[model samples]
Target: MDAGAAIWEYLGADAPVADLPAMGYGEVASGYATTHSAESVGIIGGGYVGIETAEAFAEHGLDVHLFEMVPHTLQPFGAEAAATVEDHLRKQGIDLHLDTAVEGIDGAGSVERIGTGDHTVPVDLALVGVGVAPNTELAEAAGIELGTTGAIANDRYGQTNDDQVYTARDCAEATHTVTGEPDHVPLALTANRAGRAIGATLAGDPTPIGEIAGTAAVKAFDLEVARTGVIDEESAAEAGFDPVSVTITAQSRAHYYPGGEEIQITLVADRESERVLGASMVGREGVAKRIDTVAAALHAEMTVHQLSYLDLAYAPSFSPVWDPVLTATKVLHGKVAG
Candidate 1:
């Protein structure tokens, strides 16, 4: 994919594409095996791939510097959650530069340094974790229509603009369950689900796929972070709702439990309808599994008030009598009612 050159060109780097090492995901491990002795490494992009790769290199005792064009890493997560992760990464000795773009990758022959607008950082290895672009060349050649997201436009049954053509996975867009708008989220589960629906439809069973909530999770060092549905303030408003959110920090288990850990949960709801819209959580433990509870609420269109009373299991080893998810929902329910 020549990712490094692609990013350099995208950022208006003076170097030619052929001059850079320009490796893709498949090439990263082999590249690293040869370059592991390098003292420092720089990564472009602060999204999931970049963040995970940076953590890997840093854990191996190499100096790691990460660059993000956006004001924060993990833009899919709300600002507050992203800030929490950024803080944790910094504490792990990762040098993160937010709101910064990689202007160039420079060296005589092999990679040596990465340039931001104001300064340059010396590096033995540079990785480009910027997002991928789908290869729709064959589809375009066949005159298949591309959606606004630049992916092949497909219906619920995975049929494209042309009845004879069908698309799925990273090359196709799916309907957003909340916004009722076409979205191009390339996640493994969504792809697998969509493929099953498409297969059924092709076999004449005609099973139409339901829309997606964009649920996902990731681990940053010891912190578990997860989010589901529409967590962005602007996105909720754009989807035609007045959104209100509440964040609460509570114990993962009984307060007196010896091994209890602090869990932070954020719940977003529509002020008018009071329906739970989205959720984000960050904690040392119990963060990954809790997002599913919120995801189920979003799928069922349950209101924040209803979520507060869900029949969630509670034991000293598991959760408090008032689960963190319930606590956030209960608090937001009050705000929405007030």
Candidate 2:
């Protein structure tokens, strides 16, 4: 939406890796596929990649065994939040196995059995999304020092410790706005922002890089999931703020609108300031757009008062006079004010 040519430069960040291997990027790049003959496929990690791969394998007539070590499906994001997503996942015929961890992956050459601490499960494929380490091998091989998270460390201007080199994307580190700590948040928006700021600096304009708000969105079947700012309770606590959160269900548009859809919005605000710190939304019909609006507000350091008063378009055919996002903001404002 911020189309000042500064932003458009990041519209095309090249996709470097094709498909990920069970092990490393090199194995993936060398054309490898490890599969077995089994009715059920085991997927390790219930994060976005694991769940998506599970759904795809299931559609091809394979029963899916989704292993997530967390008591809830997506840990750190809360059980209630995970349950809403798991419901949709189960409908896709995936066997959601929480509290399960992958001990080892075994096969002669191709994958056959996935080992748990208790026993081994026979599977056609073992998909792992335990998370990713930075693809810093290129930078590392060239003697660019790596950080604790295995990312290429860059200064505020996207310059690596090496002056001539500029890096963005999953390979680079990010400065968290809330905690004032550096992290590796390999998200598209972060990459885009970094690219823009770096491009500006390179093109005769001196723009200082700002803190990243950690916003992201995803689509899982009918669910349009988006989370912006910070949702990690640990991070919130560490950031020296008492975080209060609320969840509400509302229609995407006015109830009177013929095709109105339902969505769930969750908001986190500072207990004392009532300033929105984070937001998550799950539903249909432009859910990502609505979340983006809140994300912008969070970046602008807007309070719930400003969120409630933000000018968002509305029509009986589009949204109620009060959009669901604004409505949720008003709710948080009341809770904080009271």
Candidate 3:
């Protein structure tokens, strides 16, 4: 399929029966060929999309090259959490080039090389999943207002500046569920939540949005990495809190349980309030499930003490009586206390 068709499928649209945009696999076949030849692939931008794509491509027998202009992947996730992701990526043979930018992608109508200052790689394909901008040309010509981020400036309920205007997905901003800041977070979950908020308001119930607590996860190369809330240091400070972090390396299931795996978890909290802020986990085991538990705790404004004592279900086949998250919480609580 062509790029447009691929995008349509991604958005869950039915395939065009009559006229489908034809992709030149022959004309553009060089890009695909380069991908097949190179053992290593480089991803620019270490956000959720970049990281997830890197993991997927690496698993398919390609040497994954990940490039991030920031100091680490997942800039919103802060340094400590990014480190856990990096560790997981490294285990999968992904080469992370952080604090670097791709000068350009060079190829003859297909990607053959990725160019950087003083560096060049004969890449099979240069996956430029460096995030995206609002496809707002239609909105602009129609005179819709735009946010500073180039997204549509929607109200708490997803209503744009115009009375009849509503926006979601990559086209709108959302209120931070914790900090109450209006932010343009291009996540599907945010779009859905904002849609609901808009629906409620349209139904005559004016719902207010809280601060956006960014949430994302990735399952790549059999490793699960997930994070939520403000995981970055600057974000915490911007939200008027001093941040403290703790990392825990623990078993996924009971040690006695067969096939149990190891997981690394990191929790970020306010140094003064001891309130849970953001967290991340990485493992070939049950990292996503565990990170979700912490994500829930952060969303509900639960403190470390509360999360530590959460009445979580347990079984040796799935989890220990005290899950890794509970243990991490207990660890964080101790740090907060003493």
Candidate 4:
């Protein structure tokens, strides 16, 4: 991996907000928290990083005020599904401000308060989690091409334009299986796989990196959120597929089982091809593994019909006669036919 990237400051980009000068210069501060002792903290952008960091601070007895311009926290999960996790965040004592714009983060040398146009929240520190762009300065100077996502351009084996130079991890893009195109995922899992493939290539064994599964998971207090593949109708359409989506609520275990939890699954499939496009899940337990099953199906390019008949292990205490995953695809398959 190269130098990775810095947090992008996108608030009030064109017009300067009072004391803040430019996008990256101010309106926010740059710092990550392994731990902090401040009484109150203000977090900008309620995406993955912002929500997790807010949860961590709330658990440590620090007052947290999370601000997001969007109506929901997790953009990938959609507003409806993301609301479930947002509810839990509020119950955990995190002050959430939805559909709120922060004008600037101002202080002498450190952040003292965040001005959001209508109100100002006092904060000892501010963490910005807007997004990142790859550090390709040196690579660009060396005549290396950059992808559409502004990340370093490289082949599947981490070989750059110059055969003598190689790069991997967050700096480069990977071929997404769904789109059959290069995308900047920058997740640790993809980074690790790319690193391994590059090592094999250097050892005289050419190991072209496999396609990305487009999988990710995160825990929000009591809820564990997992999703993979396309999941959104717009994305599926942009990738050249007629998308069909369905949502189902199922039990995590047999009805007769003593301990079980409610699992909400939203599955998307191709309308014409009946192929499983993507899926998302929100629940307390059995989340990480269930999403992995779908991730494997995505890797294998399984259709909705095939996924419906998957021979997953089942036990009264562990899973119901028909697992939640099967229930979701079986429903989606019917819709595909209809």
Best by lDDT: 1
**Reference-based TM-score, model 2:** 0.82
The model with the greatest TM-score is 1
Cα-based lDDT at residue 179, candidate 2? 54
Ranking by lDDT: 1, 4, 2, 3
Clash counts for the predictions, in order: 0, 0, 15, 0
Q: What local distance difference test score does each model get?
A: 0.84, 0.73, 0.73, 0.80
Error of 3 at 17 (Å): 16
For residues 151-242, could you state the per-residue lDDT of candidate 3 as single tens digits?
88777666777888777767776766656566777777776676777788778898644346667777656767777887767777998988
Model 1: what TM-score? 0.89
Error of 3 at 197 (Å): 4.1
| Collision count of model 2 | 0
Compared with the true structure, model 3 gives a TM-score of 0.82
Per-candidate TM-scores read: 0.89, 0.82, 0.82, 0.86
Q: For model 2, how does the per-residue alpha-carbon lDDT over 73-163 read when each residue is reduced to its tens digit?
A: 6543445557788888888777777887788888887677886868678775666788877888789888887776678888888888889
Residue 115 C-alpha lDDT in model 1? 65
Candidate 4: worst 10 consecutive residues by lDDT?
A: 1-10
RMSD, every candidate, angstroms: 6.3, 7.5, 4.8, 8.1
lDDT of 2: 0.73
Per residue, candidate 1 scores C-alpha lDDT tens digits across 244-336 of 998889999898888888888888999999998998999999999889999898888899988888999999988999889988988999899
